[model samples]
Target: MQQQAPKAYIIVSNDKNEIQKTSAYTAKTLSSIIKTCLGPRAMQKMVLTKINSIEMSNDGNSILREMDVNHPSARCLIELSRTQDEECGDGTTSVLIFASELLNQIVPHLKTLHPIKVCNILRKAKDICINHLNTIAMEAAESDLINIVTSSVATKLCCVLKLPIPELALRSVQLIKSSIDGRIDVKNDIKIEKILGNFDECEIIEGIILEKEIIHSQMRRSIENPKILILDMPLEYRKGESVTNMEFSNKNDFTRALEIEEEQIHKMCGYIVDTGADIVITEKGISDLALSILYEKQITAIRRIKKSDSNRISKATGATVLNRLEDASPKHLGEAGMFEYVKIGKEYFCKLSKCKNPKAISVILRGPTRDVLTEIERNFMDAVKVARNVLLNPKLVPGGGASEMSMALKLNNSNDKEEKIIFRECGVALKVIPSILSTNSGNGICLDVINELEKKQNKDGPYFGINGITGEISDMKNIVLEPLVVKTQCIKSGFEAVMQILRVDGIIESKSK
Candidate 1:
């Protein structure tokens, strides 16, 4: 008997309704492949690239992006991941997981409808979903800032650990917010005095003080009256006379002029010392002769006064720098005179007399190792970025499990005439509600049991409501019943993913004939 070749399965339809088949099993197999990594207990994956390897997180977006999916639909999921990342910065996994599940739910219904009909329904559902989400979003309260912050942090922790300490999470949020609020820009040549042990003892001080060892052997161990000089100009002296082109006839004339210039620089320094100024702050560098005179007189000096720093110090201290060093004296120190220095850990804190703030806030992060510190820093920065957004926006809906439920329920009840076909094809789509509920319950039960044991073992508080919801618990609990939001986001994500996946359908090709 002659052998018969098997028929190819078509996965995509062209604009002219022509079916282009690849493999019939590809979409189904791809869907099942990602389903295993869906939930909280999902493991991490390590992906190696040409340059380096990235640690694989069970995060939906991360796993999808890391994988080399060849099928058209699977590739669409990757674009969906990118869209989620760009829009929310966080919800990448949720977008993909829900999207994959949505496709899975649609495949059976797709068997009954034309592919074009399925695509049309998807577009309509997307619009309905977006509208429903906007309505739910408006229901979010702007007054509940703390609840919003708590919810955001809890969501972050949920992705990292099944059972996270809510109180600790809240405390971390507060610390971050407080640190941002207390950030101070140090102005002037101030001292950072460390009061020994930790950051809590650090203080900021004004005025310049050099800790260098005294070079003069006979300089009174500590002069009772230390003369201070504040010069905001360069120590270099200009020629006494401006020589015209005719005046510069020979090198000898220039040499004598240079000598006289050197003498004037020495006289300037002598005058500064004579006026009892011990330290000088200048906007420019000091001449060699002037430096030598100050060194001989045991007068310490620092140059380079940044304009901003100078302005800030002037505003705070009520003292102006005299143009001529001869005029600078101790009497001109004004309110800026007092400064205290203390050593703390690796850095010094200089507390200026002018700053009247009661206390300085410092955030001390504790990590097991340097890498842990780096991770913590990265997480902190991410949180900070979100925090700023929340502060500016000040309105937020529920998140984590609650957010998932809200989206699901919103999609279910959404009523758009255009979306009727989608709802009809999927037939309320709530047939899978029981299964989702069952899975949600199962996941919750396992988490609850673990949390209960943890509470008993650790004697900590109850696990439920560890992080409170933005609105009433009832609202979040009824999320699955409100499928509009979930349906909308999912459909939108699906359409986008589908388009992107189709665009790159032939991305990988077989080289051999």
Candidate 2:
């Protein structure tokens, strides 16, 4: 019998050409996967997770997040989108698109030029393009902020819900900005609460809203100018340790023990009542006996509240969270102008409002269904982030690819020939934004629209691009605007990702036995 050749247990390939080919293919493939999910007219991708749940979204970061790709290059691109979202929060899709196109642009030139040379050229081009973008960027005014928010929200929401959503988002961001003492942190300060209801009924509350009800049925549901008490300790009777045991010789002995427990709980409730707290919120449980005492005193008690919610309530109402009943005092109490138990959907929520100084606020997001509400929340979050970015940076760029196209044109016109070739490719890569926008519009005149945009920018001197909705060339200055930080991050992050992918030289695989 012929000797059978042993199967290759491990394979290693250091072929530079094959590795570069793989990287390019992976980047382009990943790009094409989300290409249709780019613009206002983009298509939505329905991702079915391993746990068998479905997520339908057009947001690039969301789509890539749910994908379970094993390819290294694909993961890098996905991580790039995540980083963009974390840093800028609004240009996740644009960064990925630009990065892929940049790779696509420079891949062909790799055979003629060194990878390090290409990387350096692209790096220099990125800096120059960004500086040019900065020169063209205009400062954002108060009204212009709403426009920027509207532009971002308009892409994800329907026309009917567009107008009000941005208003709510900007208002929430402003509330967070104004309330904070030193720093403005939108992510932690703003709380988004979603309830199933009419979408048009969405509103922002000036204080926290907890999805919890009063512990006792007889407790008051509404109070005016209530003093609040927040607790970190349990109001229930303490339990004996596992190592300790108690034996009762008679049933009356056990009854005496129960009475002592009730008396202890009553004394704890008396501490709160003495503090003149109209409402009590605890991070731990409250026993039935304690609830009865609070109810008799007409105090509304919310038990088992989340720690984060308790902290926010403290911030909103100027209350101090106490770990012991002995530490309760009038000075430790917080005051709210109004406290009410509101029934939303099939559940009851505790609403605290009209605080004198509230550093945290709740945005109530309502929709006809869970999926709709989820999508709205996702889109609203991006809008909030966009508003925050603008408030922090206060700079604006013409949206709908005008800024990108202008950067592309300027990058191409650089004086040095060697640098000119690199800039030309970079410029062409930047044009992918408008080209994809045109393609997704289904106008069937992508090339025509691109040429028209270039002509308009060349003639009108920037601030001219295709209107994503109408698929026609228009003055983007009056039509739409995006934050300068978002655009700047897109080019910087995209180029970095392309450089990472292009620098890969080989892959070594070892199969497990």
The candidate maximizing lDDT is: 2
Clashes of 2: 0
Candidate 2 Cα lDDT to native: 0.84
Q: Please list all clashing residue pairs in model 2, or write none if there are none.
A: none
- Estimate TM-scores for all models: 0.46, 0.91
Quantify all predictions' global Cα lDDT against the true fold.
0.44, 0.84
Q: Write the per-residue lDDT of candidate 1 for residues 1-513, one digit (tens) a residue.
A: 666665555444443222112322444455454544433333444555334654434345545665776665556566776665544334455455555555545555444555555666666655655664555443334445434433433334223632222233333333333244643222122222212242222222323333332333333333332444556778887533566453777879989887888988887887777666545556677776676777787766555655544444443444556777667655665243344443434444332343322121222334334433333333333334344444434444433233333334445554765455455433233222222322433344433433343333234221111112221122332231112233344446655554333223233333321
**Model 1 ranges with Cα > 4 A deviation:** 1-76, 103-120, 138-144, 153-365, 394-421, 424-494, 499-513
Model 1 earns a TM-score of 0.46
Relative to the unseen true structure, what is the C-alpha lDDT of residue 457 in candidate 1, on a scale of 0 to 100? 23
| Candidate 1 residue-pair clash tally | 39
The candidate that wins on TM-score is 2
Minimal lDDT window, size 10, model 1 = 462-471
